[model samples]
Target: MDISQESGLVWTEVDLSGVFDLDVDESLELESVGDGRVLAVSASPDVVNNVLVTDNGVDWAALPIPNGFSPWSVDITGERWLILGRDPTKEAPGTQILFSDDRGSNWTELAVELGPFDGTAWIGNAIVAGRLIVAAVQSDTWQPQLDEALDDDMAYEPSEKHVHLFLSDGGPAELVAEFQGWYTGGHGASDGFHLIISGPAAEDYLLHSPDGRQWSSTIVDVHVTDSARNELWTADPTDGRFKLERFEGVFGSDQVLTLPDGIGWMPDLAVGPAGVAAVGGPASPNDELGGDFTLPDISIEKNGYELRYNQPEGGITLWDLNEDSAVYVFDAETLQSEGEFQGVSEVEDASGSNVVFHDPETGAELVAFSGEELAAAVTEEVSAAYSEYDPDEFIIGWSTDGTDWEWQTPQEAFGLPESTPDDNSFTQVQVAVGHDFVIAMVQTYEFLGSDFGEDAPIGVGDSQSDSTSAYLTTTTSPSPPRWFVARVE
Candidate 1:
């Protein structure tokens, strides 16, 4: 697969297949810490998880996971690593937060007081804003109901939900704001100066904080996704169509782009020095097979059932799937269409102002990490930092206008790998971009088809379900999925 057509950069596949003796169905998560360091977390059953750190793309070292703490997510800033997880050893373990100042060498648990809740408390999102760490916490309480009318069958229903915003400056986290409803949705974003936590309650509400301590609430009609510099990117569906908008302040926003017809809502958005890219895909319900939908040089069967096709358009072909998705790129400043590509499942910004797009159509899987001019722009900004300012001190740098800052690009995009992977499927791809390298985690199931027979189990020890038995009985290999990592310099 071509890494970049413009830059002629090719992906150098990294052989991390033997890094951990994990089952094919185990979950792996990656995050790009600044200074060319990438963290990989292998989450297994019963908290037998592994935290691996890589300073370079080729070499990896294992980091200790705090005792009894099953990490749900990890966030890094400078040399500090914050892990949000649950410690089953706690008497009333709900959600626990651990802090490491020396790159996971040691850890200290941050005392978090989530008020009081009968159910579980979860850290929805946590981000490092300058020296202060901000987190959105959500608690849900469920009440058990025993219905005598139905033979006393017990059922649990959500009885209460609460959201809280917490702030900490390398010490115990302090609750700054709390709400009755799940307004924040445990979602938060920061662009150095402005921090926003927004979610759908009775109506959409956004909680904005400038210093992570003082916050103001505003009702928004759009769902804010990512923030960069002083602007916020949101998926605006107010006009009954998928629209991408850039918000300058609380209420001021400019519509960036409206997705094309037949395309569902924009599933992903990535902002980098090069520009902004939005992924729109998987044909809308209105464009199903029965409709009079037409494409150039393509024939459609007018059957009620769903139809999937690949059509070449604008220098790329739609991915061969029941539904098709495309990537729309726009100039960061002009907000004009840069271009669009087909078969791209997700888009992400690497640490050095680089943007990476993953196309999993070709059996080998294609990744495009482009934008050299933007990388230079980021280097210039970081070069202007104070002489004493340590690059390992924080992920974000301070500046006069807040625009002169750096960000540790999000480690992983939520709801990614749009396609589910089965025993014979190989369509899962995850990419993480660092300052010096771009790592792609490609999951392939070709090995599984041969390793396990029709009756043999695959994921045996997993407590989630009897996936092994289910896979052996129900799954058929169209083409077994393959797994590998591609490191691009």
Candidate 2:
């Protein structure tokens, strides 16, 4: 179903292939940097030139990266942009921090010093707090010793790991404190007031600091998922069912929410001004089969080959991997379940993966693939497998509230030709939300295999690929993905 023509929702497509190389880059990270602007960085480990900034998400320009530095993460607060990377060419080969005052037009690397320890160090987390830049640095030292067990052979083992918390104010970073433990890097979050760094010992072991200098250590049982303002959202799995808990602070007035049945463990949770939302698929008891959702009995026949798509008595549909996965919305203050919507699965690490974005003027907005209607045409006939389905029909779904949703085909939304001139098909999609707009990244794929001919007989199978093996071998080259900006009024 599509929204009314007068709904005042418009989508514009923006080609990013010229500036960003989506073919070589595995994933893209996007963050809203306020003022209707968004910062995107390509997560290619081997490439250094992969940064872009867009003011409207429709026109994009490349942001230059410093030479000899491979950045892994980018953070921005206000006008300050912090880039954390490693410069292996340095003599000590440790973590390097780059600061930009004018939105990345010029950069300056902060002189970070790791005393005495001669080894490699990398930045696990970095944030811009007001005018001070805080970073968590982990260093690993190699210790070599002669082993007597194997004829005095030389053996090397990593020495004790050290975590250093550094604070800088437009100058060289000062080492504030250091700890000795095995730090699990890449686990951290900031709530605009406090910084929380996880790991170095147990998963629950955390280091908290208000100004990046004085820190306190604590161990919490709940897994912290997101933080907004002064509150934090955690997933509590002590009982048999899934529970979502919100804490006023680390230990303050808290509210516990028992999620509905069929939701998977530790579903993605997000907190915003509008409310809290959790999304995940149903829990699969076994490894080889799907979750506890039943699928419809559908079949199609052509050329002596019966294309039957059936689910085991109590399994999900073969076409929709996220049939039962849903988005559950709740009140921001009372933690009451407002409503729920189905067919939205969670994509890990994407900007707006399983979260709901709150716009003060227009309420909440969410963008995701229409799992049920995505490949509906494939169930009609065997020849339909090779035919070009409408790329713009029923591909993406948008929602203002959790209950009411609007659907649009990619062709209609992006103003593409009714028929793709290159025979490219939509494969994956991800979206990021801003205050006034939503940015969508759609990946297209081209079938490379010649097995799906007009006269070929396609057989039914137990798995999704088994029923249609010809769709497995597809390529993204020649036709790259696309980016779209949607404005809702």
Candidate 3:
């Protein structure tokens, strides 16, 4: 499970069995707790149905679930833990909101229900500017044949979408603001909550919530596809056509697009310090959106994928499942296609002498410019590539030109031993590096055998599920992990 990429630096895995109770099989989702400690939320059972709370990633504690209904998600704010879920019984109309104090030792349930729309409720919460704001879709919108409800665009309110907001409190999550149509994505920034919602269905829109209670909407906004440098990006979706716009503190600016025109079915958009690129769309589209500035066209499967901007150089790269695990790279400024790079390790910077990417299926490491062309390389169905338990080894490499990489292993680069990693246990590592501190989250699957998810259900109510076995199952995807924080010089 090791990625051939070598980060020559030393990384130590601190034991957080104390915080996580040694449950390696749980799908741990990590969030920084303003304080020195980290806030971890994990499943109460083998599946991602229940949730547990941990402060230090060493010792853990359980939260109170009122109706025995598993929580859908928990919102971690500067001061509170808001666990949100739906009551699975007929008595409660489906919605449940619980508020917890600092250590999650106690919880209070509020009367939050969707009334008539119980079956169609999809709720979420995010900490915005030190406040807790909750968003819910009250429409049972869906397509009968669709595997995922989120993709059912026809199910959404064509004329308008309703987005409800709730403020953080002790007794109940107060419903504050309600807007039209459904909110697609929401991100909390310091100014407020930046939300991308469908306006009049398919038209573009942006929402700004100064506080959890108030929301303002802007129409014909930029269709932001990715976030970089504290700002969001999207090809201009105005005039019901394509153009590129960078969303700053506000919307509405001159189109930054310099790509060709008449591209059709453009699903994904990406931008970097260098330039912008659009993928997928009509082969010959009317130049209604492409004005004078021609933004180059970067082609890939026009559906179900997005472009990732390589930082430091602003090059664009994406994995094309249709292309048989092949990764295509395009220059940022010129938008010309670079050859496919497959199965190396970490993404190298523009200046690195060695560039590395990995084979999506085999987890095989391929060095850049090693004369290995993996365009449509055969291995396995690209869909089944990596999972939560499948961990890859990461390394740092140097390349004189970021495009071609002559990767260096830790032993070769820093003179470390061949076996210098923290352990043989395979799990994902999410590291947050600061000026002097680093929080490395070491994920493992050892907890599947542990009794972590086999315990009694958390809720107590007449509406709770009677079958305790319903509460436990095999661990879910993206198995959770314990957090280990250290300082780096």
- Which structure among the candidates has the greatest lDDT? 2
- lDDT value, candidate 1, whole model: 0.44
- Report the number of the highest-TM-score candidate: 1
Off by over 4 Å in 1: 1-9, 34-36, 45-49, 88-93, 115-121, 141-144, 147-160, 183-202, 223-281, 285-426, 445-489
Q: Which model is ahead, 1 or 2, in terms of lDDT?
A: 2
Q: What is residue 359's positional error in candidate 2, in angstroms? A: 67
Better of 1 and 3 by TM-score: 1
Evaluation by TM-score, superior candidate among 1 and 2: 1
Question: Clashes in model 1: which pairs?
Answer: 425-481, 426-481, 443-482, 444-481, 444-482, 444-483, 445-481, 445-482, 446-481
Rank the models by lDDT, top first.
2, 1, 3
| Superposed model 3: Cα runs more than 4 Å off | 1-9, 22-24, 45-72, 86-95, 101-105, 116-119, 126-134, 142-161, 166-180, 187-193, 200-204, 219-427, 432-436, 442-485
Candidate 2, TM-score vs. the true structure?
A: 0.50
Error of 1 at 392 (Å): 41
For each candidate, the alpha-carbon lDDT, in order, equals: 0.44, 0.47, 0.41
TM-score of 1: 0.50
Poorest 10 consecutive residues by lDDT, candidate 3: 458-467
lDDT of 1 at 382: 39
lDDT of 2 by residue, 345-431 (tens): 344453333322222245543333333322453344323432432212333444433223344544556665554445433343445
lDDT of 3 by residue, 1-489 (tens): 232332323444566554455354444444433223333444334433244444433444555555345565555434555666655554744545666665456766655546645235555443434435455544544435444454636253223336666665344567776766656656454556666666555665777766656777777445433311112333335553232222232121113332222222222222221122222222222134332223323322324333344421446565555554435565555444455433434454554444454456776543342112222221222223323222123332221111222233323433434442443222333333222333445433322344445343321011111222143335322245544443334
